[model samples]
Every structure is written in C-alpha cells, then in structure tokens.
Target: MSTPYAPPAGYGDISFVELVPLALRFLGLGLKLVFLALSYPFSSTKFSLKRVLWRQFVRAICPPSSIRQLQFVCPATGVLYQKYMRSLPNKPPVISENIGDGISLHWMGPKTNKKVMYYLHGGGFVLPAVDGHFYMLDWWRNEAKKRHGIDFSIAVLEYSTYLIDCTSSCQLSKARMIGLINFAPWPTQLVQVAAGLAHLLKEGYDPANITVVGDSVGGHEVIFLLAHLIHGHPAADVLNLEKPLAGAAALSPWLCFGTETTSWKQHGHSDVMPLGALNKWSGWFIKSRTRTDDSYYFEPALAPAEWWGGLEKVAKNVLMAGGASEGMFDDIVTTEKAMEKGAGKQVKLEIFGQEGANHNEALVEFACGDAPGSTNYRMLEWLKEVYA
Candidate 1:
C-alpha cells in the first residue's frame, strides 16, 4: 500500500508575519456579516450568514486578498498541499472586442495558429474579470511549447456580471441580455464561440487543435459546450463546423445547481457566497435579462438526458480536475455520477490531495511560487495527447 503524502513538520504553526493579516481577514468577514445582517433583508439576501462565517473561517486559516483571488488559491493550495509551484512568467494582454454589446478576451501565447483555448472563468457566474488566471495562462503557453513544440493561444471570456450589470452589447444578439441576467447560457455561448473559432480555423488555423478549458462555473461551460456540439446546435454554422473538439478540460466544475452539497453546508455562512445564493441571484439576473423563467440554462440539472445526447460519444477525451478538500466534493462526485448515468461511460477524474486546497486551489497552483506536482501539468499532458 502507498503512504499518503504529508506536509513538512510545523507547517500548521502560524508565523508572526502571517498572523496580523489572518486577523484582518477574520475581521473582514465579521464586518461583512454584520453588514449583511443589518442592511440586507433575508428575503432579498442571496447568501447565508453561516456561509459568510465559513468563508471567514477558511480565510483566517488560509487567506486570499479578495474573493476572486480565493477562487484560485483555495483549490490549488488545498490540492497540492506540500508542493511548491512557480509563478507565471508574464501577464497576458487584454484585448477588447465589440462582438455585440462588448466583450474582452485576454490574449496570450504565441499567435501562430488559431488553435486556441477559450477559458471560461469560475465565480458562480457572478464575479468580475479573473486577472488571477493570467499566470496560469503564461505557464500553459510555456508548457505547450516546451512539450509539443506547438504554440497555443488563449481567449479568456470577459462575460458581464450581474453584480455590475454592465450594459455592453456583444456581436452576438444575446450578449446584453445574458450579461444583465447574469444568466450566461453555457450551451449558447459555447456554440457561439466554437463557431467563431471554427471561422478562424476555416480562415487558416487547424480545427483539430482547438481546445476549451474552464474552472468552476467555467468548467460547467466546457461540458455544456461539448454537450451543445453533440446535440447538433446550429451555432456550428458560424464556424467551419468541425467534428467535435480536439479536447476539453474543466477544473473544479460546478455541476449541480439545485443540490445541497457539502461545501454548501461547510461554507453556508461564507461572506463571499451563501448557500443557494447563486441560484436566486443568478435566476433573478436571468429573468430580468431574458424576461422569462427559462430555467433550462439556469438549472441545468433539470435538463433531460436527451438534451446531452451523444456528448459522451463525442468528448471521450474530456478531463476533469478537482480538489478533495473543497466544499464542492459532493457536487463534483454527483456530477461525475450524473455524467456516467447520462453517458454510461467513465469520465476522467483527477482528484488532488493537497491539504487545505479548496475551490480556488487549482488557479492558485499556477500562481504559487514553489508548488510541485500540479493538475495543470496533467491537463497540459492530456492536451498534448489529444491534440498531437
């Protein structure tokens, strides 16, 4: 039998330098809770006080400067407990485009070919831009070139958030409504972008080399895109309409929307997100934007198996990476099971065993200075195998 990995001795001991900041985080969460309780009404509140408390508790133990930052750190640090990862070499340049309302894409890597990785960021579908993922993009580019000698580009989707309710128009007609509702449909957007990538491929690039990767809700986007393609959506007409995709990867994907997962209980009091808050806020955003319940996109779990027909047949090379410690363990497991039930085949699952690694750890691993053994490496390897 193999022995489980353990962190260095005294890793649990807090240093004086780290204590003050930790204290501040606790204070922050407490203050946020007070703010919610005193100001926000329970009926209108999206998150629970307990969830806020849990976020604070976790932050005090291992704090990230902001909620967006936490999405990267929690998963990475928790999964790769003892390993030290190197920081990303350089930041990617942000490019703005007027698709319809407006959308931004963080372009990275050598722009040799249109073999791109469209990254859908994770933040329960409500958070702002994920600048934290820039380092990960840098590391991915370096690894792809080093291993496969093929230059890969990245397009980080800058979707509008319900929080900001930015009134930007995208080239796609649904952009403004999707942004306002904060109900960005994974299936719809995937088809739209895939078509766009297909167009780029037809213009010159290789269709077999394009890949899609997302984290958290973004992870869900990856699956949704594959599902959309398998279902024969018309969005492929915009692009060259290739077979399926070269590959896809999702890290810590938020699979189930209506279920009460363990993380829901553990972080129920989290200041950042309360249990069941996403559904309410996201649903409202969607209803407000679309002027309809249209629960299909908001509550994907309710969709029938037929809706995802042929997905497993097409995306046999899909890769899913998740942390064991995060609150979403049950949700991930359920999603895997649901995929098995729907696809009737084993989906690749990579569960990281880093201590304290939570929802944000995978993103954190790419940015950490001295992390060893990353799932990102595994993802890069898989991409090479599938696209080679």
Candidate 2:
C-alpha cells in the first residue's frame, strides 16, 4: 500500500530564475501594446473593448514561457496543489494506491460505487491537469447523487493530477529537484489506458455502466481508446461482446495531427495555445514512434467515415463541446460530423459551441463570463442522459 500524502515545507514558489522569463514576457507585451496603439490609427480593423483588451493581454502574457519548454524537469511537481486543496476542501477525492496496472486512478465519489465515469485530462499530453477539472468532477458527482440516488465514482486515469493529489510532498519536491525528464512513448500510454480499464473490468465493474470524459489531447486519447474497443482489441474483450459504453464526452478535443486546421489560426486569437507550440508538441510526440503522419490514432481527420461510426458501438452517446473561439473548434465540429456519418445513427450526440470562448474553455471553473452556459452545465445534462 502507498503511504499517506505529506505537504510541502512551503508554498510551491517559483525561484528568481523562473521569474526572469516573466520580465521578458512583460517587455514583449509592452512592445506589442505600443504597436497595437500605434497601428490602431491606420488599421482598417474595428476593435471592441473585450477583443482589444483580450488580444493585448494574450499577446503580452500567454505564450509558452521558460516554465513550459525548460522545465520538463518532472511530471511530479505539485506546484498547483496547495491552492487547489485550499479552494475545494469539501470536494476531496479518494486517491487509490498503485492499482497494479501502474496507473494512478483518483475517485471523487462513493468509494464502493459501481457507476464509474472514467476521465482522461488534457494538457497537450505534456502539461499538468489544473484544479478546474477536479472541481467540475466533484460538482458532477454531487449533482448525480442528488438527481438519482446513484453515487458517481469518477475514476480519473490521469498523470499530473495524481502526481500532486496522490503523492507525498517529499516525493513532489525531490522529483522536481532530480530534474529527470522523459515522456512515455505514444502507443505505450494508450495500451496502458486499455489495460487500466481492463483492470476495472477484472474487478467486476460493469463496462456498460462506465462513462468516459476528456478534453484536448485527452479527448484525442478518448477517440483512440474508443476506436480500439470498437474494433474489439483483446483488452476490451475483458467486458465481453464489445458492447457500447454508457456514454462519452470530449471537450475541445485535439483531433488533427501533421496539419493545422483553418480554425486553428481562425480562432487562435483568444486561445493561450499557439499554433507553433501545438505543431511542435504533436510533432515531437510522434517523431520516435512507428506510426505515420496520418495514423488514425494521431490524425482522425484523415480516417474514413466508418472509423467514427465504430464509436457508436464503443459509446452509446457521445457529447462534444468546445469554445467557438478555440483554435480547435472547427476540427471538433468536423469530428462531430465524421462520428455522425460513421456511427450510422445508433448513437445520440450533442455538440455545444460556447460563443466567444477559447480552447478548453469548458473545463475551467471560470467561463470568461461571455457565454450563456458552461461546459459543466452541458456535462451535467449529458451525464444524466447516460446515467438516468
């Protein structure tokens, strides 16, 4: 059994070295502001208060700073933990010990419950899971309990969150300082995901009662996993007969690889993720693998219409939600079309486009206050549809 978690000696503060990039970022933003002001007189573009201010804010502060590129130091850092725990003590989750499949699964509701919603978090397969994700899951668990007498068990098959949320502080700080750097190769992680689910099935949990949710690259993982299950991978056979899942959802799922969709730049203005970074990350992940640039797992857009249809047998209902202003919006919109075409009407589907919202906008607790509803609101409706 794993030991209980311990807190860090102090707040996870950034060193002066880390702040050097902040200074550089400010200078860069200042120059951009000067340029925006100077260019406003001659430019033909009409500016709104929100757009102009946001454009400036993003230009100045949202790029990949030294923090991201340099500090692949450890996936084990709990830098975001203390703040999250303080903010949401009422929604604490049960972090499982090494479940033997080498995957860290965190459960957010009734410890003995069988109704499981397996969640995979997004961060371009590189960054950490933020606190908004946990809060949203907790809210869903509470709502599910209230509406139906069911205890929703959220099995977070995630990495970064488990690093902080599950481990001891001595491990967190030392892991950061050790500066070890390595990422699990492509299909290896996917295979482990299949194995993780198999473990649950092995434990006698019903696959028919399991639902799935994910965002961004995690959403990509969802699609890949479904495709594998629908095709009857031996791992999925643990549940028998390849029966469809109860339901599934993906938020602003990153589906395209190799080429940027027109929407990436079209909607990049309000998004924090830059096209170059997206390209670099995706490209970097696939470089050492055997998969081609157009492999279905890596690039679903190029796959046949039937590939998505396969998911109908994989998930009975699939909900996809994204910010209209997100760089991946068009791609997700296209994915919905492909799924509908391929699934051949067996699956119920919902597509939500949050107007003026940016990428992965639905997962965060903050909604930018510009849209009518939230990702969580739609998620609740979808959760009820599946569980009820």
Compared with the true structure, model 1 gives a TM-score of 0.61
Candidate 1 lDDT by residue in tens digits, 217-297? 777777666655555444344332445566777787776655466666765344233444555534434433432233333
lDDT of each: 0.52, 0.62
Model 2 Cα lDDT, one tens digit per residue, 212-234: 78888878877777777766443
Candidate achieving the largest TM-score: 2
Model 2 regions lying over 4 Å from their true place: 1-62, 66-93, 147-150, 160-183, 232-242, 258-260, 367-372
For candidate 2, the lDDT comes to: 0.62
